[model samples]
Target: MTTVPTSAPQRATAPPSEGGHRRRRSRRTRERPNWVAGLTSVVWLAIVIVPIYWIVITSFKTQSNYYAENPFAPPGEPTIANYRLVIESDFPQYFLNSVIATIGAVIPAVLVSFMAAYAIVRGRRSRLLRWTNSLFLMGLAIPLQATVIPIYLIIIQLGLYDTLLALILPSIAFAIPLSVLVLSNFIRDVPKELFDSMRIDGATERGMLWRLAFPLTRPAVVTVTVYNALQIWNGFLLPLILTQSPDKRTLPLALWSFQGQYSINVPAVLASVVLTTLPILILYVVGRRQLLSGLTVGFGK
Candidate 1:
């Protein structure tokens, strides 16, 4: 019997209509941009940028036109006289003072905070470490206003009053707690295996910190540094109370002086404000990527 060659059963295929339905379903499920979120972002951007726009425009206007006309109006004839005045005045000295104080404060604050945070995170558990951490956190709770009088008296007793050192020291002390908190969180995210490996290789605690932790924690370091820099640079009350001499003044204090007891030079004052903001703006522009990365990395973990 020549039997018909047995053939393998064919698997059934889905109809073309079924495939098309899946594609259509996927297309329908695609996400759309959120219009409400976009609108809110635009509104926030305008709120931030409008003042900057007004400041820049006011900086270019003549003193008389600055006050007489609407602030939002475009300049009829832009001039650099305000900047020129700022440059020729004690503004440069105050700017230099601010730069010095910011740098001095940031360096020590970053270094000390890093070490303290590393110790807190990695050292043996003890009441001392706990107490220290609590104290650091407490620093955040004590407003600068409450301590201003005590700080002033202390500065005078130390003969640091009227000196940039007075401003630098206090700012560092005030900034340390927040810096420690940020750095400690970042440091804690570092892998335990790395530390163990370093130890197995005979790395000292200091060596491990410098080699393993510092490089890993750079983003947090930059964030803390920038934060401290901004605080010291823009600080007013401490400088105002500590330093009495105009030559010893900081940018914020100098800006305050631009407004006389009897009259104010709004244009000159705004120009000074613009100048005062430039260094910080430049810093943010340059370090924004690091700052953002650090924030995300520190917070995400």
Candidate 2:
């Protein structure tokens, strides 16, 4: 009685943009799965994981069990006999040799490459340094296989063959090229203002290099170290051609002990394989983040 019938309130409608967004989202929801990517990843994972699974399973089995059972089957009665065989067969000697060679190569390669990269980045105005950088790039094109003969000859001439030094020297040489490439790119991305400020604080070029370049490029250093360590650790060809004595054998060569012309100890061989790969696995797990960060640092630039 006091008022006329209240007018019906209008419901608010979504704007065109919001309506379009919902439609687009619905279309996206209907899109097909990325089968190619998923399939490719599955295939690649199988390729990597199958071998690792075989190796691990074989390592736990006895030699007779390995032959009697399906190759892919898990060990029904896992034993440490294969590992014991590996230990008894001079595996420790071989492991020591590998450690020596890897450390010897990686330390020198990283250090020398870091200095060279620092020079290349900071010495851009010098024509000689530019040419030197080109030379390092050229080194990348020279395959290790092509240089094998030369390296063998050089090692022979230097009286370094049949020694861990033979393995280390060539590993360092080959490792430096890639290390310099990675590190120089990282060094180039460092802020120029930091260098200027260091100079203003009476820092010598060398001082600035050690204090600034070294610290900043640590991730790259870790990357290079891990990369080179893996290379040296897994190196079969180098050890094969360079070393001769059984006592001086690296892990790769020592694996041959599990094989004979007429008979083979498959489980023992796989035990050795597992042992050889463990150190590298540990190294990667420990430094994975640094390695990835270092590798990606220059990509954004």
Candidate 3:
């Protein structure tokens, strides 16, 4: 009984090895459920879901029923006629045009942006590159609406007026600046030691760029690509001004068909909208992981 008493003294005070146990107790005391944060998240979620809910539910409604019935109510009689009407119109042609223009613009813009970003980060000593980067930064300040007339005149001068090429060219020009800015910052976050290691291994700059930098920065690449595609796909002004003929119209322009001289086909228009959003929704889902990762790339260790 006397010999067993020695363990009692040690149990009264926690051993140094039990610091983790103390920390766990302290953490439990500190942590609490944040009611304010939970409330704000629920509010924001409702704000976003309501509009999408209205659009999807209304798309299944008939034009007359959309106005006569409660705006927020589920369709009294859900019908696919609105969808059928949108499809009967030249929906496929407009969708194809949007695809053509978005693809045409994004591919070249991303390629150029990536290479320039790599160069800007790696060639910081070059004065010319510095100036070029500044020029790209300036492009961001120039709004698309501000240059509408100038772009129109230039497109006419280049004889690309009323063509998908007209839309593609301007979209590329507008996209490059922002894309370069995002990508260059991501490139800078790359470790200098990796670059030096690759150099010491007798790799050329091109090899290092493709093999090392490209793979490492894939999330950024996907982020910029998806963003640029969304912008170009939803572009209204460019398609509106650049193309005159109905044949050259894009998916955004397809909405114009639902607007008559006297009245609007609200349900049919919403149906067209639903169809138009599918591609973008698919794209977002596919790249969502990359997008979130890219956005938070250099936030902290």
Which segments of candidate 2 are over 4 A away from where they belong?
1-33, 261-263, 298-301
lDDT of 1 by residue, 108-168 (tens): 9999999999999999999999999999999989999999999999998999988999999
The CA lDDT at 65 in model 1 is 88
Model 2 weakest lDDT span, ten residues long: 255-264
Q: lDDT for each of the candidates?
A: 0.89, 0.88, 0.91
**Residue 44 CA error for candidate 3 (Å)?**
1.4
Strongest candidate by lDDT: 3
Better of 1 and 2 by lDDT: 1
| Tens-digit per-residue lDDT, 1-301, candidate 3 | 3654444444466465678889988898679677889999999999999999999999999878987999999998999998898888888999999999999999999999999999999975888999999999999999999999999999999999999999999999999999999999888988999999999999999998999999999999999999999999999999999999988999987777655521467888888889999999999999899998988877866
**Each prediction's Cα RMSD?**
3.4, 3.8, 3.9
Poorest 10 consecutive residues by lDDT, candidate 1: 259-268
Pairs that collide in candidate 2 are: none
Model 2: per-residue lDDT, tens digit, 124-214? 5788998889999999999888888989999999999898888988898899999999999889888999999999999999998899999
Model 3: how far residue 222 lies from native, Å: 0.7
